[model samples]
Target: MTDERSSTSPDEQRSDPHDSSDGETADADATSDENDVNENDADGNDNADEFTIADFHDASQQEGRPVLTAAAVSRALELSHEEANERLEALADRGALERLAVSTDPVVWYPTELEDLTDRERVVVFPKQREIVVDRPDQFTRAQLSQFAHLADANGEQGYRYVVRPADIWGTPHDSFEDLARTMRQALGQRSDALEEWVHSQWDRAHQFRLTTHEEGYTVLEAQSPEIMGNVARQKLDEEHVHAPISETEDWVREGSEAAIKRILYEAGYPVQDHRELESGEELPIELEVRLRDYQQTWVDRFAEAGEGVFVGPPGSGKTVAAMGAMAHVDGETLVLVPSRDLAQQWADAILEYTSLEAHQIGQYHGGRKEVRPVTIATYQIAGMDRHRSLFDDREWGLVIFDECQHVPSDVYRRSTHLQSKHRLGLSASPIREDDRQTEIFTLVGPPIGTDWEALFEAGFVAEPELEIRYVPWGDDEQANAYGSADGREKYRIAAENRGKIDEVRYLLSAHPDAKAIVFVDYLDQGRELSEALEVPFLSGETPHHERRRLLEEFRRNERDLLLISRVGDEGIDLPTADLAIVASGLGGSRRQGTQRAGRTMRPAGGALVYVLATRGTREEDFARKQLQHLGRKGMTIREQAVERGED
Candidate 1:
């Protein structure tokens, strides 16, 4: 009978989509006449001649057999195999029939009564009240499938019948179910109606809404209901009504509200999924070399316990090393954000030197190269750039370390907080901002987790700092008059640029001829003047990034004893080798800036010295005192030293 037809004939044989029960092929042809007689008798009419695909489906269901091969139906109906095959395929396309794979080359058609098909005949099953069944459950390992079944059984009683919470799944002591059901669904190659219902339920109850960024660099909330929209707009000010310029259906959040929206969602017990693809980072290749100091260890413990917060420590107190230790403890994909390219390089070097990460694993995402790896070191400027924003948009960082976190309150840099991270650590010598935006830091990064500098100095983790306030007389009479007359910004600049401060710089350099020192000035001109007069390298904002790196390397290598720096040196730049720091000028009355400069020389050495060259009996003295307040609170004594050049 098989050889009576051509090989290309539809009934001649092909692989069945449904795995046929054993010996069903021989029975299929034998039952053809019986099926036709039964169908005619059941209908009580002569409609066997006009039977359609729908009629075939109804007959199969009524006969309690949901699956059929095209050849069986063709023989039963006395029609050509080609016509029957085409009709069956059309029914399958219309959802009245389902096609299942039986072998590599053949498929069989089934009526959509999935539940009626026995375990032997069906490959997959979605039971309404019973556990899911799969005939070929070989997609996952037996152990994996067993674990999934266990979780399903446990959580099924907890009202999460179809959906699995990641935390609940991962929190249990089991092998990693990294992608949860998403992975399982992909492997199964089928979707359950129950799973779709669960997804819809989750979406309806989700407290966290996505603040997605459009191509124009704007962000908007994907609000589903009026209540959610109202909740989002509750804190918006009167002038900031929700706008929907993109579409009438969707409401747009104001620019820079992304962080606020995230905070809101987090507080409401809804963790927003940023829909970013995260790289599964590899394990560390090497172990750490230096053991953290006792205080540093305590701070790390606290940071790990809190999961997110700012770590405030004195300069030269090993904040960078502590941060690296935290990363090693977490041992995940880390993104370290810095204010400058120099600091980014410094972080990269620290990661390589201290952690198990190799040179290839550490990528610098700044001016020259933007390669992202297991450990990415990026600058705030680069992170805030619109073109570079995509690098952070869809990526998930396991640990995010913000060096000099005080800079994050600014509008340009605050956008860096939008990058999703599991754990956040903010490292800063002083998190105080001039604009009273320290609250914003607390909001973005958690509250300040601080270690006392006095305790660190007592423990010998950091050098004891000796503060010397040197009185330099104002040499420029015209500038002196301008300093007295000018208000606000001009007055501060005039006082900071006093030419007599250069004499103090010369004296400090002369005093510390062999010691490695950093001369910090507020203005670029002051730094240049001192650098040339003292015959040393000058680093400022205008200095090329490569040259700055070279100069820093030279200082580190002890090829240069004295180097001049500007405002750029106030933050996370590590100059551990420098034993002396001469503050030539500074921003008027910034305690944070002063503490950071003093910290520049506080690395554990024999001792550290900081000389504040200020014009006595002017606004400079008050500003200088304000800067000293940070150290004063730490119990470091400041001594007044009058610079009497000829007398000395």
Candidate 2:
């Protein structure tokens, strides 16, 4: 099993009378942290005559606590409680460490010293590991990091961890290495030689190959050096994919093998830059009905500059509107691909509502409808069909949009990318998968082109949802025994379907009776049980499309404040604005699923809340934390609470 634990930040922990309030304090009174708490301390304590900032950092990370109370500091530093507080307060007085006082403990302390870090005090760079730890980074720093680094996790407080992956280096939206390097310096406030060298090498690797159109109107793949063109491209591809070598550094790519070539080279770690002079199709003028947000305009401008990109933002961050802005910029025939018919219809209505496109100008192609117009919305399944593919393949689409584009790597959705659209655009809040195929999403669609979620949240452009994981005790011994006797996924299933969650769900609904809420479940039986208990409608895949639409419409119109939905509500269903989201189960799903469920409530003006119900001390607890870690990484505070066997 994956080790992605649902571990919370130290301060978010609930005080338990049985456990030490300050982490092992009961056993650590006489024990020296030099040997017990920290591994790096053995070498460091002897090297320094006095305690250094690195010691504090090491102690905090080793103890898995961001903010420590006086007892922890006293134990780790081997000082008296009063002395530790005096020293910590002295540092705090000098603006080295910051402290927050809570009712449950003496003032908790931040390890870093702000006075020494300058304006970049919040950013900590570990060049050797290619990891960045930022503490309470500002919008500017977060924005700079988004340009070249991937947010790996957040401590659900002030701390964020970012990792610079190969895909991030390959898909950096900068025009040149100098610009990217400059951005790194700006974000970090200092140049890191090791990190910069690695980044430059990866940046250089991305430019080693380029795809350009020949004067004869066919595609040619060129390499930076003849050795790469032969040793890499030619060595990997056969005659079926590449026709012949145009030269030592160039290859004549066979027809209908462009996507294959791109995918192949991408897998080989050299992202081919597309510079081909492709078609713009027939001009179809369009205008946006609403004014674009500053960030949305930036997304459009970046796409227009890059010619292809995926809009990666939180759900309510207006990606659809930004896409319409892109359509207005492209001003040509567009093909929008969706995961479901409901999304197709939502896209049509959104296009009409947010843009100047008339009803006749837009059409939908799916199982129920087959209409093609300047702006055609089609399901990915229908477009991937052999018989129906021709309609899309024959069209000279100027722009192709993949909504919910996380499915692009799947076998069915992968085929839809075969359509020869000049400008490929993809839209997804989480462009991630449970498997390793996530990189192909970038290769096939485009590099991610959107601001950081925290930036949007900070600017009040999108409401940052408050996420909480509530651990409920089993309702009875029978269920607990069933969970204990079960094995593997069966155990997870038992925990997920715990009868206690039903009570928790009812409690949450009663607490927020006026708030529009969605209760999500994985299994039909669990959903039915919750539906019956709460007297709410259960909307699952088994529900007819028309009925589903009507229920969603009623929810959107504020006629219904509650609905129990299955996995079908996870994505692509245009779920209406909700102030509350409760995951009754399904924590075993992908991290993206948690984000999508929470995103249903992330509107601009309202206070968004998400509660995940995990059976206490069961496997569901870990799954709950791991799945929602994505949201935490995006700068949302996640709190945890343990419940009694009975209702409060």
Candidate 3:
């Protein structure tokens, strides 16, 4: 909300109304007060009439309150307290407002109607629960929360709930606790002594341990005090993590166990401050061919300070470009690790297109190719193998980058986290896991440096697609009977593969004939049937890499209008942006899968659409909602509609 308000009619405008001691002379008094709140003298509001019922919203916002006190209203509207209280009681009697009396306030007024809350945003803090709820928040509020809170859930319409987790406070990229507190006050619009005290204690908890490189070239883990070292660190750690105790508060960390040490300490309630000076490798000339956006530059600047971070942003938000920007900032030999050969190829192409890296200087070290140059791109599986580990041992890498970093906490994937570098970077739109090991992502890499997805949507940097979940009836009695008899996963699968959806898919594709689209199917049988019906090629795991490359290139160049893909296209392979996306099956997939498919059309040009199809009167309906819940949390609206059964 801004202090400066725009001038419009009472119904259209949100501004504080001038109160009159007496009716006809009130306009003159308002003019003299010169309240800038939503008044437009140029818009003929100069001859404004008496008070409007809607004007109370202006007073509420001006006073920075979700609920208004009579004193606050008096100060905002230039009226006496008695007049304000009388007006509030009248409005309550008219059913336009409600009043509540709390221990801290005598009485406060809130809108009886939800639409009456016309403030730019509404924020409610539950200090005891450590949660913040916001409705239709602006970019500034979202950015503030990302620093020290985790987005827990959203009501799918206008409300977002963020929970302040210990990890959030520990990994906060602030200079001091005072600065963090100031940001909290700004975001919350008020200070909570109880919440601030809890936050301060957590902030102190994060700084209780430190990891540093010693003068003799060994790593040391230090605690804030001897008691902490003995009680927390010493009791939690073992000889595998550290060689021995160097002192009461310092331990000589074992070689190659630095990551383990940090993880153990962090899990034990102390976050280790890493200050080891590592190699920046031999300098390699590099520069970004494209200009960095303001937020991308800020991310690079922050990472340059911390030496490690994950670039978390929605799909099509130019994360690869930002990674290139980070590479240019470091200007050293870089090793980029991806999840698949397709992504490795995409990374190599992006580095070439956006950076001044020579083609010959870059190499791919996967099953298809094994060349390690100054700038190498390899798959995570290969790079972590004991045999392939020797390939990277000789050449010092200044930076190690992980694409699709949500996989970093897995058993095999975590092996690659042991790789030492001066800088570490990870990229993922959704860095979540079913096992709840997401915290390991931060400990393995670094704190997250991300742009709020809403910021990008508002700035038109990414399109917020029109998302709809359409539930279709079963094609025939046979399929309906089969689903009714089955239970558990089989029942869900039968519902998801409902034959009725074929016609719905045909209808949607026919309706948007000019729009480029991708239809995602989970099983091979369903994919083949849809491919045959739509007369489109289905790309799946069985498709040859070269053919996948050819079809994706055609799609990117706009030569192909429609394509069918399997779960393989959910991630790892960068499918070209489409104008429409249809989930023909697999509504029960993971939340990441749903978002990855919806994100195919989330480009800056807008006018994107995503249709999720589920069988009506089955568990598939619930599965569809559950799958897209992550997008709901990210501020995307999900509309639901029922499909009419075709004439039997």
Q: Which candidate's lDDT is highest?
A: 3
Per-model TM values vs. the true structure:
0.57, 0.81, 0.83
- Give the per-residue lDDT of model 2 (tens digit) for 300-398: 998988788899899888888889888999999999999899999999988887788899999999999999998999998888888996667667888
Better model by TM-score: candidate 1 vs candidate 2: 2
Q: Cα deviation of 392 in candidate 2 (Å)?
A: 1.6
lDDT of 1 by residue, 222-291 (tens): 5555665455544432225345534432456665454575555544534333322222244544456666
The 10 consecutive residues of candidate 2 with the worst lDDT sum are 1-10
TM-score of model 3 relative to the true fold? 0.83
Question: What clash pairs does model 2 have?
Answer: 96-113
lDDT tens string, model 3, 503-531? 99999987887788899999888888888
**What is the lDDT for 126 in model 3?**
83
RMSD of each: 28.8, 12.1, 10.9
